[model samples]
Target chain A: MSDQVTPSPGKRRIGVYVCHCGGNISDYVDVDRVIDAVKDEADVVVARDAMFTCSDVTQEEIAKDIREQGLDGLVVASCSPKLHTTTFRGVARRGGLNPYQYTQANIREQCSWAHTDDREGATGKAISLVRAAVARTRLSEPLEPLVVETTGRAVVVGGGVAGMRAAIGLADMGLGVFLVEREAELGGWVGDLPKMFPNGTDGHELARRLQDEIHRRPAINVFTRAEVVEKTGTYGNYQVTVRAGGEQIRLDVGQVIVATGFASYEPEPGEFGYGAPGVVTLADFTRMLDEAGSPLVYHGRPVKTIAYIYCVGSRNETHPYCSRYCCSAAVHASLLVTAADPGVRQYHLYRDMRTYGRHELEYIESRRRGSVYMKFADDEPPLVTSDDGSLRVTVRDLLTGGDQLAIGPDLVVLVTGMVPRDNAELTTALKLPVGLDGFFNEIHPKLRPVETVVDGVSICGACQGPKTVAESVASGLAAAAQAAAVLKRGVAELDPQVTFVHPEACTGCGQCVGACPYSAISLVERGPAKVASIDAAACKGCGGCVPSCPEDAIDLAGYTDAQIRSMIDSLLVGSET
Target chain B: MTPVPAHAGTGRGPRAPHGGGPRVLVFSTNGISDPGIDLAGSSHMHYPTEVVVISLPCTSGVKPSWILHALERGFDGVFIAADGEECAYLQDCSERSAGIVERAQELMEAHGIDGRRLRMAAICSVCAEPFTRQVRAFAGSLAGLAEVAA
Candidate 1:
């Protein structure tokens, strides 16, 4: 009890302010009484109330008071820290105090509005919460952000449009880039396509153009027939080892961008009349269309009718998610067929046409150009049966009152979807997180779309999820911009609230090794005694490994054990409940 | 003379607001459940004033001694607002947090405290209703225990 929150009277000068919140709080709790309650406490040199503690004038006044009185600890009983921890930390900094010296007490959300019916109770609770914060401030040691130097190079996995574009983007920003492709050539899945949508550029031609640009850049090194075998070290100083041509080459880099592309889904034998003479996947059909002349001949048969099936292996119980780009690709393919020969009859069997955005015009154009789209329900899917090298497709038309329709055509094209490539080896080496859909998961789908939980690692292109050519390129450049922003500054700043390993208390038990999520903790010899050592740069300050140690040897810096215990004691003294 | 720590008023008078109610200390994850608890307040959802929340970076960081300390300091119960899969730190966050709760419960049993006094449930980022409802239910159970003791 002697070492608990008893701030020595004249040693620590603290300032406490309770906000009225413009009646948001004062309507329910007595803000002035809260000030009167704690003003006479030993360490409180200044106790005040503000109409809005977050206001500009009040902020200036708090800074002025801190400077005039030489106050060390500051507490503002106002809004949640999520909203204004930075705003008040600025005041602490301007007053010549460390930013971590400031503490926020959430009275509006946690007290006043929560217990509107009981004003007396809310005030008592507010006093407890604020005093608990003040006690924590009294014990908090000033901490500086951890800064580490960074290598000025990045590694891009895969040599698809996204990877090639990311490498070009990184090199353009004056950073060296290493582009690795699994295949013998520089192009990837996108490079093998017939003609990409939204533009009539040939796949091989586009790949050649990107390859030429990459070859011209002296900073960009292209490695074909390679794979990222191992990655070690923390962010900003990673050593990535790539295996190429029976040799392993290690590259020191600051960031790793995973642009590994998706795999084309292949239908099983006899499913949707596949393995028959005329039945082929959309990918196979497109390649055949590129080789054949007008009238669309396959197996030397020029006179023909074609039927297409949508969503071959996705959007069901097994996959349970829509492959986003198939509908537009199918519609664009139908337009290409019509351009070859307008007299050839074509029918598209589908469920939910999702040609979103401007691509909706392509669906409309395909329909206007003599291709018929028949909608089908989920339960009543189209069935394909072959009769002597010819195909018959039957479906219940959803748009036309569930009417059953049957059509015999010479060609049956199955519009297969994209599936995530099984990157089991790479996943283990980099600790990449995979979603339920089997695609690599981002931190946030919208805000931090390219960044992974692993620091300095970014996922781009179809490997993350299904994306069109344009979207893949967009994410590629975005990952490059993020990597550039991290490495170009030549330094990385991490939170100082990471865990601290007390050597005297540690017994080298190795309990915290398995507990650390970031693999930041390791057992090392300390004066012939084994002890846990933590890499502060790799730690995310989650304090996840603190409780796993049996000896209580490790603790978080900002929210230490002594500080937490003192906080609870301050709120519970004189009570035996 | 050293400054005396400001303590909560403990008048033995007629059940004061802070004196009678079962005081529960909550360990909430800063990234996930803290914002949800705050949303519960912003939505004007009501819970007992006896509920106090202390935000930690993650629930896995909770030590069993912290729970025992709260109980020994006269807290009626301890609630852990877990982060579940929403924890950006670890993929196995739920399992690690459950391990902590188990150890805390064992400590409670050793100290002659009922294991039922401590509770844990996953509260996500926007789960305002769940946050209020669970805390209210926990308060009722703690109050019933008090009645049984009396």
Candidate 2:
């Protein structure tokens, strides 16, 4: 850690650099004019324009100025701070200035690139941006990252295929794992499935293989009929309590992986003739087909013709998203049915065929095997009815110019989609955010897919959203990798930008307590007074508590009220074209 | 107006512009809306050069006075890029921000400032095009208000 020399407010020596970005900024914003305008700003000791501020030569020059001029603060007028904040912060550190005393002016993204038609306007804006940055920097102080020690352990929730795989992965990495399952056994929905797609592997067999691997690892401790009821403490040092059997078991772990999987959407009774004589869910029908002894029978009658209803519980009002696995599941089932009896007629009534990726091949093969697919309009869903001893499905076939057709079939299968498992208790325990779609929300779907807003916690598998077996397992490994990355070093550093409390100013009004989402703030008795205290590790630094304090007791560090007012003054005072 | 006791540091960028059109001061969140607006610039999307932004930790952290202060300090408009449901910290950030906007609007009205000059909307991390579209639309409305007054 670099030593931080506190610079007094009036004596703050700051270096300001305007970057050309090789005309990325200079072409639109006159860099020399920006430097000229901000050269005489308060606390600014050195101001200059650079062809490339991030270049090694310019960096050395800035470092030399920081050392020779004894600069304590820095303002770099360059591209987005997102791109080069760290580079110049390192420059500040090497120059004996605290890194937090540095700030960046996003001239490229906010000014130059945004105003290509007006160079004079861009230059004036760049000048103001630099001055504001200098103003913010004048109040900037050194900040040290909050480092939390880890327990070298992880808790995997769900006990599904994803959870099992994640447990095995964590165990292999030499981390102790607590694999918790709400059920009596390991395998989740996959265990109940007869077969899965692509490899055509028995779903139960895949679950068994993962369970065996987990059992073989002594580091993995399985807790069946157990669930994490509460999670406390900060990242890399979490204390979780699992409700298992008839007792509460507490464990200290570094990370938690939510591979909670998902539940299949069940239709309401009488919807799509769901409770009819011959109608059954696709899950029930598939199991029947697997154990049908070469002849599919429903209600003591051999099934001659079968009609499959796709999207019965999905693509509708209740469930809007398509269950990504059902199309392949149904197609794979049809191939199984064709192998059993080529004489049996199979009809697929549905909307658009979304058997994406390799599953599309399964769709074509199912078609070549004489499985007729009928397109149905979204508004006009197919209807299923039961009579004396028969089942019939009526549908408007859009492919046949929207012709309505009705036929009786021995068996009717309702193709259901995946739904989020009822995890209100666990969701509350972990404080995981469920999306508007009721699925676990991640930070970013593509960039940081597995991690959640809660530090040391990540979501994976169908619980995040519907996914094929392969995709589920892929996300499972990603969550394991995320947990490992944070816990491997046995220490994790949280951003120091998190909230802090001013004890003397705090009236103990408790308004800030409710405003804090992480529950990091609490009112504590200090002598005869109650004051708000902030736990730095738990605070995410969203600043939601700042304005909620009527006493103005709570304020952010770098974005303090004084700095903002100064920046505002710098922008408006005698500032015009 | 006092020293930050021995505690954590807050990180943010404060940006202001000088140009034509209504100078809009947007209080954008660091984690959510700032990146979205940056995406607009990287995509070479153009808006009025006068739309300056002061990045905040969260929109809920913005005091109502900050909004009124920007307008009182010669800014024609004050926009808040709230962290809606995509907020990483609080679940009710948008609601809190809405309350701030309401109070700020009431304050603006008391000061005889046009309430239409202030606005608040959710700006997600990936809402780049939406951010640009919002700035352009807000700038247009502020310009219209100026014309009507003239």
Candidate 3:
């Protein structure tokens, strides 16, 4: 109450205008009926209904009416304020009235649209909504927005293709970007591969292009072997701390993009002979292929037999998922190896030959070559062991219905899988929810893929979960697009669906304040009595404060229990249940 | 015959490399029956991937696995669009399949794969994704995997 923005106390003149929204609401909920019913209300000075109150021409009409009619407060009963609260607020400011003195009533989604056939009930609900707004507007204060400082620069985490893409996108937009990489180099796991799918260009080339572009950009600041240590503040202004090369550096940023990428499972050294001289993971194999520019050779001689074990880190009752790329990578690798040496006996010991797409054609052609395709059931996996000092694998052959066939192979290639990163730390740090698989969760699965439940934060790349390079790049662009939308606004208006404490009725009970999970409420001394005030920017409209209020003083805007009960009563008024 | 886990950490809880799981998930982009039927069967034995059977209509439906995090939290693993190009839903299965595959692999590398437990795949509508078999084999092989030292 030290600097309360209470409105000037006096006889308040209220204006109520209902919009047709070009029949979006008027058709179902009788707009004229709503205006007619509220016209006689004690404090209402003018009540009118318009075909489209949100339209530019109509908004201008509203501003003109306020000036000529000397209106003190305004109420617009139209679509959800989510769509036009700014529109009406802009009009109020232009008309020399404090924009905070306006109230919005949603009669579309909650009433008319919800109760389609019940016209009488719909109209009654509309009246209640209007009445609630009117009541709230009567207690409205002339509030001013708090100006939080902005940090001009931004931090882009994760140095993968998506991180690089976002960093470039942000830098090109004239914003300084700090690109951080967890690994030693800028190119992510993609750099270790042989080539990309479809277009089939060397993965190293794409990595180089991105690395060079980022390096050349003057606005881009690159940091490898770095991790985000701390982040605070709100959207458009954030203070981020990073730990890189054992040095802690703090930076003020306008935004942050979490492109922390994903990690594939690397089996323990002993399991599957992963680290043995003759054994290698698909990633390692790919790296070796890239290094040698050819198939694997043992002791400077062409290898006669090579055994590939599929589902090394994926698909089991325990792990229960397919590392989607392993099969394709194996197929691609097999094709490359076969093309390099036709006489090489390549046995693709798999539960299934998943050479999908053009690889299917390749699998078909490669099988005709010296490459062998075998299937093993989930219950019957291939066993790799040394028989008489010779590396041999025993697998149940699905085609021949046989078991324990030993093949003295020269090399064993294990195809591994992918999973989320150390997401628990990330989830706790950001107060974000993790999926069952322990990945960052998005707000809406389809509509808001990049957006989180928290405003101003977005997730991209494998940090969210499993995905391919192309998909990761696309999601990176999507997250950037979403973050840009919020940044473009420069300042976001706090949503009005928040709770307010009746200062006079409050008894200094800290229950409600403590109950607020969003940390929106606090008590301050107003003369003699301690009053609770809500920090609107931090409120998330969760209504958690209501139950903890012992004085019955806390009331929420847009959805007070009384207002909801009244609306519900009206909806069920003429129904037979 | 012993059940080949769909993912790692099937019988042994923490020993499986990286991935976490008790539930088995099957990542199928198309029908359960496909040209690579054996691969689909193996997919059912892995750790997290063995719990839920996610039949994606197309690779495009994989989204950014972050989108379905709620669903993932409820299960052990999430097996989605697999590797290969037999998708009847999306014509560009090659790119879409590759995208899903890459995403899953990255997750595994990050140690978020349930101790390297979760998985994803790429497959066509007619034949369940081939990555399913690979996932199962990977899980079965995790008996000797080292536990993450506390």
**iRMSD in angstroms, per model:** 3.0, 2.3, 21.7
Q: Model 3 chain B, TM?
A: 0.47
Output DockQ, candidate 3: 0.02
- Over the stretch A1-577, how does candidate 2's per-residue lDDT look in tens digits? 0122233346789888888899899999877677667666667778887889999999998898899889989989898887798899899999999888899989998889888888877778777788789889988888888888898999999899889989999988888999999999999988877767876899889888888899899999999999889999888899999999789999999999999998877778998998878888888887887678666677687778989888878876777788878888888888888887888899999787889888899999999989999999888889888888778899999999988999789888888888999999998899987876788988777768999878899999999999988888899999999999887898998878777777888889899988876788998999998999999888877777888888888778778877888787666544343
Candidate 3 — what's its lDDT?
0.63
Writing each residue's lDDT as its tens digit, candidate 3 over A1-577 gives 0111122334777788887777767777777777767765556777788888887887887888679778778999886554577889999999877787888776664445544555665676577567656665666666665544445566888888888888888777677888888789988877766676545677788888999999889999998988787776765677778888999888777667888777777888667666566678887777766766445576575577889999887777546766566777787777777777666788888876665566577667667776777788878788777645467777777877765566778888888767777755545455554554556767545656877645566788888876778878899888777666555556554555567877888998787776654457888888887888887666655454664566767766544545433332222121111
CA deviation > 4 Å runs, candidate 3:
A1-151, A268-279, A293-295, A298-302, A307-309, A315-323, A347-412, A498-534, A542-557, A567-577, B1-150
Score chain B of each candidate by TM-score.
Answer: 0.87, 0.87, 0.47
Candidate 1 Cα outliers beyond 4 Å, as residue runs: A1-11, A17-44, A47-58, A77-80, A107-129, A197-204, A266-293, A297-322, A341-353, A364-398, A401-417, A567-577, B1-26, B32-52, B68-79, B111-150
Give the TM-scores of the predictions, in the order they appear.
Answer: 0.83, 0.90, 0.58
Query: In candidate 2, how many Å is residue A335 off?
Result: 2.5
Q: Clash totals for all models, in order? A: 1, 0, 102
Please state the error at residue B59 of candidate 3 in Å.
31
Tens digits of lDDT, candidate 1, A1-577 = 0111223376688888889999999999888777867776668788888899899999998898789878898999998888899899999999877889889999999999998888888888888888788888888888898888999999999899999999999999999999989989987877777776766678888889999999999999989999999999888999999999899999999999999989888999998989998899988887887787887888887846889899999898877888879989888888888888898888999988899998898888888898898999888789999887768899999878889999998889899889999898888788787766788878766658899878889999999989988899999999999999999999987778889899999999998998885789999999988999999888878888899889989999979998999888777643121
Worst 10 residues of 2 chain A by lDDT: A1-10
| Order of quality (lDDT) | 1, 2, 3
Q: Lowest summed-lDDT stretch of 10 residues in model 1 chain B?
A: B5-14
